[model samples]
Each structure stands twice: as structure tokens, then as C-alpha cells.
Target: MSGPAMFSRYEFMIAWRYLRARRSEGGVSVMTWISLIGIALGVMALIATLAVRAGFRAEFVDTVLGANAHSTVYMVPQRIENDLTDEVYVVAGRIQDYDGMAQKVADLPGVTRAAAVVRGQVMASAHDKSNVAEVYGIGKADLEAMPRIVDPATLRGDVAQFGPGIAIGAGIARELSVSVGDKIRLIAPEGARTAFGTTPRVNSYEIGFIFNSGRYDVDRTRIYMPLDEAQSYFNREGVADEIEVFVDDPEQVADWTLPLLRTVGEGAQVWTWRDASSSFLAALDMEDDVMFVILSVLVLIASMNITSGLVMLVKNKGRDIGILRTMGLTEGAVLRVFFLCGAFTGVLGTIIGVILGVMLALNVESIMAGLNALTDGGAWQPEVRGIYRLPAELRAWDIFRAVGLSLTLSFIVTIFPARRAARMNPVEALRYE
Candidate 1:
């Protein structure tokens, strides 16, 4: 005859009976409740933490790629040696045909758009307050094409009359105590170099638009001026300092470096967004991994409670186990019965924790808003965290990993107590009776 099947109905019945046993009768005790709650809490914490980490990383990368170029092509001075005199000289100080290069790069297969820009540092003053700003001279069309600047949520002013005025960041406007249609003076120190010395050129321009890119540094320190005006202020004239190139997929920008270098020709280098922000991204990734490992320890400790509960369960059920063993139940069957008890607790706890974690992650924005309101809007600091708000993204992989970790620890810790209960001799178990 075939032996009883593994984890059969009777085994489940026994496990369930044991789990529901009264505290005085060697049934499920306070330890069981504690273990269940601990696992649930540990799982919830892991999922929530991972979701927030993922969201933070995504938001940071989006802000960076949305507000700036995927790659930039700029001229770098090339060292050349004179053949006759053997004297070293520098050549190709600036892009000779930036517009042509931009047009050519824009035609490349993966490139979305290429715009030549003149960038410089200047002091902006209005209402007697002044701040240092990095100004980008770009065409109205190109400025509008930028994802972050054109976004309705962050844009505060109009870009229609861009050429007649300039677009300043919200932080800059606030610091200078100016607003749209107000005049802000831009002072360029290197304006008009002469025989005597360089003179600072101060010019007042109307603020046509304002944008908040959500990055504290960018919003506080960046300004956008019309290409022609920027060229004049920075003394670049017809040449551009760099050509900002946008692409369909920013992640693949490194793949296009060769093509961009070919298009821009010699003395020009391609600098990708990754090159500028790799360290920050790497740090975020490392932190995510470290946090997961650290939180897993909490889950392991919680699972240990299962061991304590199961060991007590085995001790309290010795008499019942003796009767069952004398009645022809196998040791393997007894082991499965107790194992199922612990496994059920882990599985149910994980399910509850997943539900709670997902709900928290989905509602994180609302919760942040509520907290900000209660705290008088002082809960978040964009300058310190780099983003104005907290973000939480629920990823399937993270959830699965948490579940696996919980279940694995639960199963491993259940083994020892299960084996002890299974190997007990019926004679010894009933000696007291």
C-alpha cells in the first residue's frame, strides 16, 4: 500500500488544530502573534524603503536628463608642434562652424535635436539684490523644446517674447525680488576687452519667463538669454561655446559618442549626461543595495521568532504527539504538520505586508503633502535632498525579493524544531502521563 501523501489534508488539519490551540493547552501562544506581526512589519519596511529608493533615483535622473542635453559637443584646444621651428602651439580654441556641426549632428539617426549655445557666468541684479548665475544663450525654439522648461507644471512665465527679454529661474527671481515683466540687470565682467583693461558690461533686460526645474542648484543659479544677446554679452560673436544634443534615448548616449565625435570633427569632444552625473547615480544605487541588505537583517530576526514559537509548540504538544505516533502516524507526517504551521504564518504575514507596503507607496505623495501642511511646509528641503518632494515607486522585483527572503528564512528556521518534534520517542513523551 502507498504511504500517506506529503502535506495531505490530515496533516493540514493537524497543523491548523495546533496553530489554533489555546495558550494553556500548548496551542498557539503570544509568541505566535508576535512572530506574525514581526514578519509583517519587517516585510512592510523592506518594501517601502525599496520603493522610496527607486523613486528617488528615477526622479533625480529624470530631472537631470529633462532639463539638460543628453550629450554635448564642444571644442577643446589641440596642441600642435611647429615643423620648422619645433615650437608647440594650441589650435582649434573654439568651434569654427558650430551651426553647421549642430545641423549635421541633428541629422544623425538617433539624435533628436542639436542646438548651439553660448554659456557664461554673470551677476544678475534686481531690486538691489544680486546673485551669480550661469546663463545659457539659446534660441526661443530650442529653449521651448527642452522638456522641463516647457512643462506646464514647472513653467511660470511665457516664452513667446523670448528674444526681446530673458528667462530666469524661479529661485533667481525670488532672490533678486523680481518677477515676470520686471527688469533684471546682467553684468558680464569679460565684456569688451580693450587695450587698457576689461570692462564690466551691465545691461537690463525684461524677464519674459520663469521656470522651476525642481533642482535647487539649477533653479537658483541658471538663466536663459536669447542666442544673439548672449553672444554679444559673452563676446562670443558668431561662434558658440558648445552644441547641446538631445537624443531619443538618453541611456544610449554613450553609443552615439563616436558618431557625434565624427560629426563634430577633430578638436571637439563629446561629453554625455552620464559623464556629469555618474557618481551621483552610483551613490544612489549603492545606497539602495546597502539598505536592502540592512533591512533584510530585520526580517531574519523576525523569522527567528518563528523558531522560538515552534520549539514551544513542540514541547507543549508532546503528549498529543505521543498518542499520534502510537496510532501509526509517521514521524515525517508530524514534521510536515508543524512545518505547515510556520509556513502558513510567514505566507499570510507576507501577503498582508505587501498590501500595506503597496498602499503606502502609492499614497506617498499625498502623505507628504499632508505632513507638509501640518508642518507649515517645512517638512522637505529641496536643497538638501535635491528634490522638492518625496517619491515612492513600487517595483515588482522588489516585492518578489522581499517575499522570497521572508519565506526562505521562515522555512530554514522552522526545520530544527520540526525535526526535534518528529524524532521524539512515544514512550519518553508519555512517561509523565
Candidate 2:
């Protein structure tokens, strides 16, 4: 027989004998039951941790991509005269031809879509209330190309209802105690003092709609207006702060961004959404690493239980080991038998834990709903935080990692006991009995 077939036969026979012996026992002992439970708990912890981490990361990516553009183009500080004119359109048209630039970025190998966005900081006031917020100006047609940050049905008024009006974030509107159709005054800084004193410009607008992006920064402090209207208000006739681009494959960001930067020339800077939120991403990575290390301690503790249980098994099967030795069984074969028994315990526990973890991940939303129902709707709802329920993302790698770790720990626990069983003498074991 081939090597694989021969090994398979040997493993099957040894595992069968080990399992048969376990079944004929006077039921399972308290210690064995304890070991089984320990393994089960350990496996469950690993599965739950992996699922939660994957889910949170996936949801965070979705939330960010929904609220912000995938990439950005901006002029370096003090480079271009902030004046907007027909020449501005000429430069924009030329830049669009560069590789990886323009609304056609989605046509690139991995890009999904691209858009141009202009943003500025301004103070908005309505009636007696005033607050500083970021004003985002966008082309009405291009806005449709990006992810919908706000649901039209959720708004008190329609975004497209007013021509020169603006949309306010839900949180900001609530804080200001203003609603749709309310008049809002906009104050923006324009022009630099050239031998003159402070230069300031102010404009006014009416609130058109209220939108919620599920992110506190965006929802609480962001406002959107028509591109042309914003330019007129800011005294920036034809110039925009930046052009935003969206991609289909976020993983290929670096590959696409570099070529686009080269195409845009030395005057323009290109940035990815990852660069925009680097600190947040770093924090999430650190949190996952810390959580895994902490949870692995549970698995280590379970492994200790396995070690103790195997030590007891060695004592109980002393005579059996001696009889097998007298019947010409090799010491290695004897060791394999006990190892199979311990491995079986780990495999069974891992399988059960995986099933339970997957079920929990799939029904997390329903589970949260049940909890809310039980609590009589007293739970805090955070529309600004993106998702309401815990997210669970299961990957094949997570399962492989869990099973591989458990089996290795099980084998390690069986080592000493298996060695002791192989070394037992038939004469001494029979004499003791």
C-alpha cells in the first residue's frame, strides 16, 4: 500500500479501539466531563471572538465608504490662486485625461466609481442659534454616483425640493432647533489682507432637508449645498477644494492611487480613504490583537484540564497498556492510541462550537431585536453610530485557525501521559491490580 493508505489504516484501527474502550466504561467520570466542558468553552470563545472582529471591521468599512469618497485630489497649500474662472475649467478638463483621473476611474481595472466634491468650513445660524459646521458642495448629478448617505424618506423634506437651499445633518438641526424651510445665515472667510485689515464674507440660505449619515462627525457637523451656489457664496467662482474619487475594489487602492498621482502631475495631491482614517484603522487593528491574546488564555486553561484528565486516564488504563505491550504492541502504537482519545475530545468540542458560533452570527440582528422587545423598548438607539446590532463575519481562515490550535493543544496535553502508558510493564501492572 502507499504511504497515505497505510497510515490511514493504522490510524483507523487505533482510533476505533480507543473509542470502543471509552464507550464500554462505567459511564464517563466527573473529571472526563469537566475536560469536555472546558474544551467546549475554549472553542466557543475563539469562534465568537473571530466572528465579532470580522463583523465589526466589515461594517466599519461600509459605514466609512458610505459617508466619504474613496479618493481625493487637492491643490497644495498656497499654490493656486483661489480665484475661479474659465481657466479653472480648462485645467480640470486637462487633468481628467490623466491615468486614473476623472469620473471614468470606475472604468479602470479595479475602480468602481469616481466623483468631485468641494468642502469648506463655515458658520451656520438659524433664528437665535448658531453653530460652526463643514459645508460640502457637490454637483447634483454627481452626488447620485456616490453611495446614498441619507435616506430620502427619513428626511423632513426632500433634498432636491429647493434649488439654492442646503441640507443639514440631523444632529446639527436638532441642536440648532431648526427644521426644513428655516432660514440659515452662512459666514465664510474670503480673501487675504494685502496691506488691508481682516476680510470676511457672509451669505444666507434656507434649510432644504435633514440627512443622517450614521457617523457623528458627518451627521452632527456636515451640511450640503449645490456646487454653483456654494461657489458663489464662498466667492470661489470656478475653483474647488478637491475632486473626490470612488473605487470598486478598496483593496487595490494603493495600486490605483499611485498611478493617478503621477498622472495629475506635481501640483496635485492624491489621497485614499484609508489615509483619511488611518488612526481609526490602526486602533481597530490593535484592539483585535489585544482581544485575541486575552481570549487565548482561556484555551490555555482548557489545555491544562486536558492534561490532568489524561493523567487520570493513564492510571485507569495501566493494565490495558501492559496487556497490549505483552501482546507485542509497539510503544509508539500504544502512545498513538491515547493521543487519538484526547484528539477526539478536541475535535468534538470544536465542531459543536463552530456550529453554535455561525448560528449566533447569522441571527445577531434578530437576537438584538428580541432583547429590545424584552426590555420594553428602553434600549438606546444610535442612528449616528451606523449599525444597531453586533456584526459577525465568519471566514474559512477563522475555522482553520480554531481547529488547528485546539488539536495542537490536545496533542501537547497527551504527550506525558502517552509516554507513561508506553513505558508500563505487564508484570508490575498485574501485580499492583
Candidate 3:
């Protein structure tokens, strides 16, 4: 029976009997079911939490890219002149350069649009009302391409009128009590001086449109005007404060940014939206790492349960082990039998967990929709401090890592208990039984 011999009918019977008995009423205790449930719940929680975080990241990134370009090129100290034309026409020429550079940048791989932008802090006044806001000067065509300024359904007038018109945010519109066709006076920081010291040089313009992009910060503080009008009003010539570049592939921002910087040379600085919001990105990275460690502890706890269950199985089957050894089964064969049993538990648990995880991740949106309905849809309301809904992104890497760790932990858990079973003494066990 030792060499090239099939397993005896009795050996097969023994394995089958143990397997069937384990599956029956006496196989696992009440505690085992509790452990399995805990594992399932833990897996579900991790999947849901990660998905929501991922969703928020995706949404915010889109908002930022919509408002700002994928990358920005601006001068350090942001000078508007280069030793020319009373520093006035120099600024104007710089503003005009936006159109040319935008064309050039658009020709680069992945760049969709390039627009010159003039941004400045200005006081906007209408009648007896006044508010401080950031004025963004952009070409009418470019403004149409900008998401923050292109919500046609919410607009009071067309953005393409190309007159001395501006688009204000919905929040700004509310605060100023202003609407399309209303006139607002813009006063720049640099004002002309009269005999009575400094007189505020202001230009009145018609509000051509209003847009709301669901972002409170932008909607409350931003105003858009044509680039030429903005430069003239600001008394800047042949120069712009910054050049905003939109890309076809936002993921290629770093790639586009470096080359553009080389082209612009040391006169300018290149920045991505990621750089604009470093604090938030850092927080996201830290949150993701902390979640990974915490969820892994859950898997560890599950592995511990597997370890304990296998140990109990080993203890219960000691007499069987002894009998098999006395019946000419080698120590290696004895070890293999118990090892197979322990491995089976881990493999079975992992398979079940993976199937469950995939289902939950894939259907997370539908599940949230149902939950919202159950709560009378109140869950869709805005949150003062957090995103309203959860987002789950199931990357292949996450699945591979989870499965690999669970299986490895299960195998590790079984080793000590399986070894203990293999080293049982046949004589003592037979005498006791």
C-alpha cells in the first residue's frame, strides 16, 4: 500500500465520513457561524467605505478641472510688463499672447484648449450694493468651453454676445441682487489719480449671463468677462497674468506641464490642480492608507477564527489520527490529511468572500438608490461637512490583494494545528479510546 498503491477503501471512507460529519449538525459550533458572519460584515464595510471615498475624489476632480485648466502657466511675482510701453501696452500684448499660445498648446498631445486668462481682485458695485469678487477675463469662445460659465439652462442671456458683458455665478447673482441685462461697475486696484488724490477708475458693464455649476465656492465669488475688456479695464497692456491650459487627458497633466514649462522657460511657473489643492490630496492619501490597515485587521481577525476552528477539529480527530497511523499510514500522509482539511476551510471561505465582495461592489449604486428610496430620498440632501453619497471604485488591484492576503492568512493559520495532529501518538490514543 506504500508504493503506487491506491488509497484503501477504508481510508477513503474515513475522509468521506469526517467531511460529511463536519457538514452535518455536529461539525461546527454556534461560534463558527458567528465568526463567518463577522468576516462577511467586515468585507462589506471595507468595500462600501472605499467606494464612497473614491466617488468623492472623482467628483471633486471633475469640478476642479471644469473650472480651472488641467495646468496653469503664470509668471513668478506675475509681472505684466517686460520693460516696454509705460508697462501698459506690455500688459495688453501679454493678454493677446494667450490666443497664440493657446493655439500652440492645443497642438500638443492631449491638449484640448488653451486660453489666456486675466484674473484680479475687484470691487463690483450695482446701485447701493457692493461686493468683492475675483474677475476672470476670458475670450467669449473660451468662456463657452468653460463648464463653470456654460450652464445654459440657468443662464439669463447668451455668453457668446462678445460685448462688454460678463457672467456671474448664481451665488454672486443672489448676493448682488443682479441678473442678466443689469449693469455692474468694476473698480480695479490700480486707479487713475485726479487733483483730489486718487479717483476710482471704474467701467460699467452689462451682465450678459449667470451660471451655476453646483460648486458653492466658485458660484459665490467668480465673475467672467472678455479677456480684452478685462485687460483694458485693468489698465494692463501686452501682458496677461496667467495662461490656462485644458487637456484632453487630465491624467496626462504632469506630462503636459513639464514640457510646457520648458517652452515658457524660467519666466513662468507651471501648476496643476493637484498642486492647487495639496492639503486635500494629502488627506485622501492618508485616509486610504488608514483604511487599508484597518480593513486588513478584519481579515486578520477572520484568519484567527479559522485557526481556532482547525485546532478544535484537530483535537476532535486525534483518535482517528492515531488509528490511521497504526494502520500503516506514514506521518507525512497523516499531515497531508489534516493540512487538506485546514486548507479547504480557508479556500472555501475565500471563494465565498470574493464572490460576495464583487457582487456588492458592482451593485453599490443600485443598493444606494434603494436605500435612499427606503429613507424617502432624504439621504440625497446636501451635507454641510461631507459628500452626500458613497462612491465605490473596485480596482483589480484591490481584489487581487484581498484574495491573496486571505488565502495566505488561512494557510498560515492551519500550520500549527495541522502539525499537532500529525504528531499524535497511536498507542496512547488507542488505549484512551
Candidate 4:
């Protein structure tokens, strides 16, 4: 322990000596441990939060796309030559050969399925309750082709063999107080234009199934019926308003969207899931960014603890620092020693935090489920809103960003204290001889 060569030749040795020494021997202070734990906690929180946000967004998008087509080729009337009349007219440009158009889109790469869809705004009334909903008149094959948002296993009755039946989302069912086998009346806005006035189309159909789509608006506003039945009721038999397309991966649906739109030719408007849900996706992205920034501030606060710990260490070990300087230890070496001490804390904490965070994020669903079970589901039931279970999608980039921010801020905050230690006067430090 009295070997001067190890202490003088290696700055790291001296740094370790200063940091690892017992309290009686003036080393390893309590503040250092607290600062380390703080950094770990901060990084852990950031990683888990980011993972949860990413997971929830992915799940929500999947759920939404399940209930909606990835892309839709709809008809929009070509502008009349110069519009000579002051006409506030609504045009229903039906897409002829809708099935053929859907097949064209399906033929394109990345496209999985396509279907002709007839959409209408309607009022659904049942059990003395009424709610405005979007009624989808989907072909039997198209309806079969559509992915299920509500697990098919959960349906009370047969959905595949639907016979003039209307499927309702959980929210709609709740609002109308209706369920499977119940009848709901739909009032369509489009009808015969008589000399006296426009007639509203009305029809009633038995509920085939109740779908829990896990989407706030879709659950509340989506209703489904057979294409033939819907067309007959709406007076548009053998014609679909739009052709909807589905892709293998909805996230990268752009690869299929443009070409499909082109396939349908000029004046044909194509709508992708991204186009329809842009606002919702954009808002989610903004919230995620804001959360990242907010959590970074917490890391910065934890980094300050690194500064505090280093400062306290420098103060307590002033004499040792001066004695080391009196030996062959240069100011730069002294600077490095303190720097390593703080840097070590940051690195170690970051490692542990990342590991802990990743583990927690990966198992968030099971962990939440376990907690709910322990508390008899009461703990989480009330909080369940669109998504009933917690989801966590661990992304390496998110973890790297969190750790990078923590370590960078931690290292930067250590500089001042390290500089102070390096500048300590040996004369004053060892004065009371």
C-alpha cells in the first residue's frame, strides 16, 4: 500500500484510491451512491416511458387499421367546364367496376386484399336510444376479407354467415342499448328526390354481432351490413362508392398506395390509412416528442446530483488531492482523476438503468396483468380506455437516446467539480503541519 510508483505513475490508481477508500480512510461517500441511484432511476423511467408510448401507438394503429382499409380508391367528379351556374350541389360519383379496380390494387405488390365499400351517414336507433353512425355496406366477400378488430372468437353469434345482419361496435351497442339478435333501425340521409321534398331512406336489420374494436370513434360510430342489403336500402345496388385496399404492412402502405391510385387512372382519389388518420398519428408523435424532452429534464436533474457528489468528494479529499499534487501528479492528471470518478458513476448507473428499463418494458403487459390480478382487476379496470392492457415496445434507439442523454449530461456536469479539485493549492491544503 505504500508503493509510490503505482500511485504516481497511474492517475487511475490514484483516482480509484480516492474513490474506494473507506469513510474512516476518507473514501466512498454516501452522496456518491445516492447520485448513482438517482441517475439509474432517471434513465430507467425515460426508457420505460418511451417504450410504453411506442407500444401503445403501434397497438392503436393496428386496431384502427383492422377496422379500416389501408387504402381506398374513391371517385370524385371531374370539375364541370367553367362552372357557369351557382350550384351548391353534392355529387355521388360511383366507381364503376369497383370489384375490378379492387382486384387491380390487390395485384400490386404489398397489397394483401381489396374490397368495394359503400359508406353512408346514418342515424341508428335502438332501445329508445339513437346515435349518428357511419354505415358500411360491405360485400359478403369484402366483409370476410376485412380483418377483425374485435377477436372473432369473442363474437356471440355467427359473423361469417351474415344474413341481412348489421354488426355494431361496442360503443354503438352501449349507446343504443342493443346486442346480438336485437334489431336496430337505420335512417339514411340519401333517398328519392321528390317534387315535394327529399325522402330519407330507412331500414331495420337484426344485429349479427357486437365488435369491440378498441378505437374510441370507430367503436362509437361504425356499423356494418351486407353490401347487397346496404345497396338495396340505399338505392345503389351493384355500385360501390369506393374500392378499399389493404396492405400486408399498413405502416409501410405507401409502397402500395401510389401505384394503386395510378392503376385506377386520373381523377380517381385514393385515400390511405395514413391519409385518413394523419391527424391522430401526428398528435401521437408530438406527445411522444414532448414526453422525451420532459423526461430528459429529469435526467439533467439527476446529473446535478453527480455534480453535487463530486463537489462534496473534492471538499472532503482536499488534503489527499494536495498531497498527490505535491508528488508527481500534474493538474491535468488531478482533473482526470475526478472526471473518472464522476464518469464512472454515470456509466455504471446508465448500464444498470438500461438493463432494468429494457426488462421492465419488455414485460410491461404481463406485469400489469399480474398487478391487476393481485388487486382483482379493480386497480386497472377503471383506467382502461381504448386499450384494455398495457403494451410496451422496446426500441434500441429509444434506449440509446435515453442513456446518451443521461451520460452526456452527467459527464458535462462533472467538469466544474473536477476543475475545482485540479486547482486546489497544495500550500494551503497542507498548511497545518
Candidate 5:
């Protein structure tokens, strides 16, 4: 404290004293603590919101990818009669020798599984209920090839033999008021031609299993049956519509494009999960980014409070600033003291807020459940398996972005008030005293 080396140390001490002062002692005012609280609240809100966003993103990706393929290989569209069923023909763009193609593509590097599938639309009815259905023409082999379609634990009934039975989604079962072992009728537009006219065909299939993927859309509309049965029913036999491919890492689906294209050759076009649902995926990414921007605005607002609080503080400390200047304190040191006073609020708040936010985000599910229980509202426990709980993920980048932006804004806000403090007039300050 006696030497020139003590200049910065004295500045810190003076700042600390100002921060710890009571109202009568000309110390930190209530407004300073209020500003700190505001900054902390803003930071906590940002981190928790980002964690929720990340959690939802992961849940959606997992749920969707479970029921759908990572990528699909399709050949040019073609119209042909599956069999000698009727006068009219079925239009199907199916890959020629798809089994061989699927096998070849499966042999490619990074390819985990490939299955030839036939897809068609129909109206299914049972137990006085009807709904539009998407029939996936997949056999035991295809089911074995793609494990994401159904979990062994959730699946019910026998599917080993297939035996003209359908594996239906749980939502569809509920809608039709039917479960495993119930018979459902599928109505196809294609039928045998007669002297009167062409008639629609109706085929009956027994429900073998009910699968719940937690995806409402898929559960309510999609059904799986043997490929051969589907081709025969749709009057399009001997060819499959497309080959669905699965890989090791779905996040890297984009990276597998070139290798997949080269392996399958030019006759067919390949579509990745990203390509098939570009708008949906884009919407998720954009939503995350949009939320980040919005929350950053809140932090900026909180930083403004820091500027305002410090400005009020500087006005109250004018005599102190003048006295320090006359005691050999440099203007630069005076400037630094006020800057530290403001910056300290932001730094401390950010640190405390980070701890609180992480704890909140990680236990969001429990918090939601507790709130629900307290309110007698069971909204947290949804009936659907996939959407039952809140998901929270605290990513490093998200934390860094939020904390860094907050600190930067706080640092920027402190400059004007600090500069004003340094330029105070000792004579004018003392005359009032």
C-alpha cells in the first residue's frame, strides 16, 4: 500500500470498499444488488431454455428415426401389372433386381442394413372405426434388418412366421378399438375387371402385434405386412418400390451420400433422412437459433441495468473520486475502480447463475412432476410413451455462447460511466462538501 506497485491493488481495495458500503457509509446501493440479480436471472433463463431446446431436438430425432429409415434408394417410376389380376395396371417405380441391388448396397462401407420395401395407401377398417393407413410391405427379413422399427420389449404377439398378419401401431389399435388378434380389412382400389365394371378389392389380415414407437403419426397410420402379400394385394408383384437403408450414425447421414450413390450406381436416386424431411429438420435448427437470439436480448437488457446502476453509483461517489485524485490516484486508476465495480456484478452473477441453471435444466423433469403434483394436474405424465418427460441437455457451446455474450454486453455497458468517474472535477466536488 506504500509503494507505486500498490496502485492497481489500491484500486481493487477502493472498489471493494465501495461495493461493501452501507447507505450511510456511501457504500453499494440497493440498485447495484438489484442489477446483479437481474443479470443472474437473465443468464439462468437462457441456459435453461437452451437445454430444453437441445433435449427436444434429441427426442424428436430419436423418435422419428426409430420408425423411418435413414435413407431410401429409388429407381425411375414405371407402370406395370403386378400379376394378371385385372384389366387396369398398377403404376410402380420399382428398382429392377432390387434384391441384388440391396445386397450390393448393403455390402458398401458404412452401410449397416438395407431392406427392399413396397409402400401403398389404403383405408383400413375394424370394430366400427375407419382410418387412412400407410401399408409398409415388409417381411420378417426386413424387420430383422431394421431394429429401429420396434423394440423387442414393447412388441407383442408372434411375428416370427408373419402368416398373412399385420404388425400395427398402438395408436391405430386404439383408434379402431382393436388390439392384437383382431381382424382388420384393407380396401384397395385395384380389383378384378368384370362384365359390369372394375370392382374394389377387400383383403382381410389378422393383427399379429401392436407396436408403440411414441410417434403419434406413425402409430396412428402405419402398418407392416409381408412384402409378397402387399405386392399381390396392390396388384403389383415381382418388384419393390424402394430400398430403405440404415447406417451406424444417423447424425452423419449427409456424409454417407457420396459413398451410397457410387455404390448403388446412377439408375436410382438416393434420399437421406435429411433430404426427405429437410423442412422439418431445418425448422428445428432455426428454432434453436431463434431462441438463442431472443434470450440474448434479455441478457442485453440486464446488462443495461448494470450501466444504469453504476451511473447512479458514480454520481454518489463524486467526492470520493475527487479525494482519491488529490491523493495521487491517476485518472486511469479511478476509471478502473468503477469498471471493476460494474464488471464484478456481471462476473459473479454469471458464475452463480451457471450453477443454478445447470441444476434446474438437469432436473427439469422432476421439477415439472412436482409442480404437476402440487397443482393436481397430471400433465407431466403424458399417455404417449415417447413424449412423457421433459428432456434437458446442457451443451458446452450453448453455455459458452450465453456466458460470453452476457459478459461482453456487461463490459460494454460499464465504459461510459467509468469514463465519467475518471473526469470528475476535484474543486467542484469539494466546494459542495
Candidate 6:
């Protein structure tokens, strides 16, 4: 701002002239192009990978929270004694006053909703096909509250007459080759206790609705029944196996654990979503860190191309550098000129890469759909990936990291060649000429 500033007009003009010079005139034009393109590709790849990884993780967590309870309150097992025969046995404890308990839990602060649930494992059969299913007994109000299941956009059948029938997942329906109005038989191993022993409870119910939760495993094994019907089928009369509790912030379930425990009483225990899926989330985080390191190495390798190109340019322009030095150009000015040559290439390439990466991330889903159409549905498999399509989310932090890494590496690699040109001996450089 005061005197002649750094990177003055003359220095820029000299750098620009060198970058535009022909190969026959002592310029590494091809190497410059190669270095610029390499940097651009590397930066683009880094940004795209990070965006996809973030999107995938976010989507996976959302599906988990959407299709399942954030936390569940369960009655702990207790020991009981039979006075008639003087026999002592351990009986599975169940929430006796589930309606009142559910209401209490729901009324607690931070609790969004709480519903009594009767869950059991049963074998389902239809059209000579059988598969294991996990049945959930939920009230009509609770079912309606679950937007992921009863949402009009994804539900295939009517839930208006839900109590008398059952709601099955799309995967289960497909596996058993059954549709709406078809009767599906459910066989429970622990049914009514009789004189000899317990017998499997077998019952058939009409399929009332089909819902797609967009998760493969959930769709494959889940079955929903009305609360009263589930209670009768599971031999759980006037009681519930557990209370499924939802909260406004699932990630902060730990903060609400004490309150939930106090409300559920001493006989009950609270299990959180993190307890169920922590390992999977940890693995995803590890994968993201590894990917970042791998791509950073790619960017470094691309920046090395800048070093090689600049070194060649320094060697080719030794005589010109000598003349400039003899004509009163300072050593610092010579260094700045060569540095700008490499910096310009790196800066321009990084800008182009940023634009391309952001565009790709924002429209990744549409692009994936196009590719799937061209490849005959081979681009992505919902069953294998657990989601319907590829996802991408661009964040400001990821973009900054990519750009910073590219520019930093460019400047560092350019320094050595610039210093070499600055310290060249004018007499030796021009003696042969």
C-alpha cells in the first residue's frame, strides 16, 4: 500500500510471459498443463469422496432413528415363588400398567412419544413359503404417529381397517408371494400352556397394509399388528413387553436416561439406540478418516507434478534469469516471478475443481439415476446397500480442506525452484552464451 508492493506488475508480466512461452523458447508448456490437470483431478476426487461419505452416514443414521425407537424401557426379569406347590421359578417380568406407564414416560421432559409394545418372534407362512418375522404390536394411534410407516407416499394399502388385520413389510410380502387381502399364517412357539406342555399358536390374518421403510433388513423381517390383537396372539394379556420411547434429540439420549429411569421405576431398564448401533457408526467414522488420508496423499502426489514442472522451467530459463539479474532485477523479484508461474496454475486448477465438485455433489442423486438407467439397474442395488439410491452432501469444511491442501502443497513445492532461479550466478549462466 505504501511503496512498490510484493508481486508487482512487472513480476506478474514476467511470470505470465514465461508461462505462455513456446517449448522451443525454453518453456515446459506440456509439463505445466499436465501439472494443472493433475491438481484439478486430485482436488475434485477428494471433495467428491468426502461429500458422498458424509451423505451416506447421515442417511444411515436417519433411517435408524426413523424406523426404530430412540430408546426402550423394559421390565427386568424377577424371581417368583408358587405357594400352592411350594415351587420357586423365574418368570419374565412385564409392564402390568403399561398404559399408565407409557403416559408417564411420554409426559416427561425431552420425551417426544412413548408407546407400549408387545414384541415376539414368529414364523410366517404364505403360498407354501415361510420366513422368520419379528412382530410388533402397536396401537392405532401409535402406528399413525410413526410417519415413516404410515405416510401416504410410501404406504401401499389402507390402514383405516388396521385392527382386525396385520401390516407386513414389502420384503416379507414379496418373499411369501402374498398381497393385500391374502391371509398370512403366523406360528408362535410359546403359545397356550396346557396339561402336557405348551403348543405353538397358529393363526391367520388378512394383510391390511404394506409399508416400505427404505431399509432392507427392516422390510425383510418386520410385521405390525394392532395392540389388542398382538396381546392375544403373544399370550400377553393386559400387559406389555416394553415401552418404546422417542425423544426430540436421539443423539442426546444419555442426558435423558436418569429422567426416563425415574419415570419407568426401579423394575425397568432403559436401552438406547446408541447401545444398539454404536459399532456400526464407529466403523463408518473410521472409514471416513481413512478415505481423507488416502485422498490427501493423492493431492500431494499431484502437487509434486508442480515441483517437477517448475524445476524444468528454471533450468530452461537460466540464461534469461541471468540477463534479468544483470539488468538490476533483485533476487527476491526473480523468486517472486517463478513462484507466481506455479501459483497461477495451482490456483486456477483448484478453482475449476471446486466448481466441478460442488456441482457433482449437489446433483449426485440425479446423476446416479441417469447412470442406473443407462446400465440397466446395475448402478446400485437397494438390497445390498440397504438404501434406495446413492446420496451426496457437500459441506463448507470439506471444500475448504480441499482448497487449502491444494494451494499449500503448490506453494511449498514451488519454493525450491523459485529459490534456485533467484540464487543463480549470472556470470556462469551467460558464460556459455
**Candidate with the greatest lDDT versus the true structure:** 6
Q: Relative to the unseen true structure, what is the C-alpha lDDT of residue 346 in candidate 6, on a scale of 0 to 100? A: 92
Model 3 residue 112 lDDT score:
80
The better candidate by TM-score, 2 or 6, is: 6
- The TM-score that candidate 4 achieves is 0.84
Distance from true location, Cα of 199 in model 6, Å: 1.2
Off by over 4 Å in 3: 1-27, 78-96, 123-132, 147-165, 170-198, 201-214, 328-330, 355-390
- Alpha-carbon deviation at 23 in model 3, angstroms: 11
Extract clashing residue pairs from model 2.
84-238, 112-248, 214-384
Candidate 3 per-residue lDDT over residues 1-433, each given as its tens digit: 4342344454445544554445443644433554455555556556555665676677667667777778988876543554656463232224346667767767877778888888888888887888888988887778788775586665667776546578887778888898888988888767665687766678888888888755667777888888878777766656677888887778667888777877666666888887887798789879988997898799778777766766777677778888888988877666666665556656666767777877787787788789889999676643342333555677767767777777777678777877887788888778879
What lDDT would candidate 2 get against the real structure? 0.70
TM-score of 3: 0.77
Q: Give Cα-based local distance difference scores for all models.
A: 0.89, 0.70, 0.71, 0.81, 0.81, 0.90
- Candidate 1 local lDDT, 1-433, one digit each (tens): 9998899999999999888968575445677878889999999999999998899888888889878999999989779999999999986466668788889999999899999999999999988899999999999899989888777777877779688889988899889989889999989988888889889988999988899887888899999999989988988888898999999999888999999888778777889999999898889989988999999999999999999999989999999999999999999998998899899888887888888888888888899899989998788778788778789988999999999999999999998899999999999999999
Clashing pairs in model 4? none
Give the range where candidate 6 is weakest over 10 consecutive residues by summed lDDT: 21-30
Model 4 residue runs over 4 Å out of place are: 1-17, 20-28, 78-89, 192-198, 255-257, 359-390, 423-425
Task: Point out where model 6 deviates above 4 Å.
Answer: 1-3, 25-27, 80-88, 366-379
Single out the weakest 10-residue window by summed lDDT for candidate 3.
Answer: 87-96
Tell me how far the alpha carbon of residue 408 in candidate 6 is from the true structure, in angstroms, after superposition: 1.7
Clashing pairs in 1: none
Question: For model 4, what is the C-alpha lDDT against the true structure?
Answer: 0.81
TM-score for all predictions?
0.95, 0.80, 0.77, 0.84, 0.86, 0.93
Residues 114-183 of candidate 6: C-alpha lDDT, one tens digit per residue: 9999999999999899999999999988888877787789878898868878899999999999988899
Residue 322 lDDT, candidate 6, scale 0-100: 95
lDDT of 4 at 357: 91
lDDT of 3: 0.71
Stretches of model 1 off by over 4 angstroms after superposition: 25-27, 78-92, 373-378
